[model samples]
Target: MPRDAEDRRLEPFEWNSEESVRYEVAIEVIGEGVAHYSALLNAAEAAGDEPEAARLRAEIGACVEERYRLRATDHEGVTQVLHKYRALLRAPGDHDA
Candidate 1:
């Protein structure tokens, strides 16, 4: 199936500056980390391992904390809130204009 405009994960970039590209890459890296740990967290929960799940949740919380340096994330329990964090990637003015 073909994907629509909204299906795109990243916005179009015209390769303006090195700093901007690097900043965007950093955001993507954090996002990938989130995805990775979230999957492991899910697996841990499915296996009925609370200890491992808590560990992964902490890892995820740390990654999320770094991703949003301005705001702290108080992640409570197992949440499927990954989608909500996607907007954080674009909201930060981390790049130099």
Candidate 2:
């Protein structure tokens, strides 16, 4: 995996208080990896390194697919959170008249 601006590769997603924030971070990670791999792919092509170019191309594809999957998961996570919040709102409390 290509390093991001922070010189870190994509780490496994950790639970965040905010699903939207986590999604944003995951997207940024994918964007960074794709950008780095794109640069490497270009260089490999320029140098006529077919093998490396092929590998970079594959990596880029995987990154894109992962990003797509992450988006769906993020949406579901947000929906689940909203449902829980709504349930709490509907629940009767001791103070309810």
Candidate 3:
């Protein structure tokens, strides 16, 4: 929600095009943080600093877990959107699509 950022508003439940895109982007950002933290952890481990590496690894694990949660929430959101737009998603002849 910073002023300098382009996509400042958060709308997890808004199914509209722009809001939906932003919500996905937000999840992506968090997911990317997991990679970033893992990279940092790798660097720490390579330096032979066991204490720092252990701490970073723990934080990286937390970040990875959080990203997993975000991904799961995104999956649920996709299911919700699909259900809400079932009529649109359905085939012309098939009742379930």
C-alpha lDDT values of all predictions: 0.56, 0.61, 0.52
lDDT, candidate 1, 1-97, per-residue tens: 9887444534464544654544555556677767767777888899999998988788788877766652112232111223334443345522111
Cα TM-score of candidate 3: 0.49
Which digits, one per residue and each the tens of the lDDT, describe model 2 over residues 1-79? 7666433433466565576575575566567667767877899999999998998898779767665555424677445
**TM-score leaderboard ranking:** 2, 1, 3
Q: Predictions ranked by lDDT, top down?
A: 2, 1, 3
- Stretches of candidate 1 off by over 4 Å are 1-16, 70-97
RMSD of 3: 15.1
Runs of candidate 2 exceeding 4 Å displacement: 1-17, 72-97
Q: List, residue by residue over 20-80, the lDDT tens digit for candidate 3.
A: 6755655555455455556666887788878877776676576455444443336565454
Poorest lDDT segment (10 consecutive residues) of candidate 2? 88-97
Look at candidate 3 and tell me the lDDT of residue 63: 48
- In terms of lDDT, model 2 sits at 0.61
* TM-score, structure 1 vs. true: 0.55
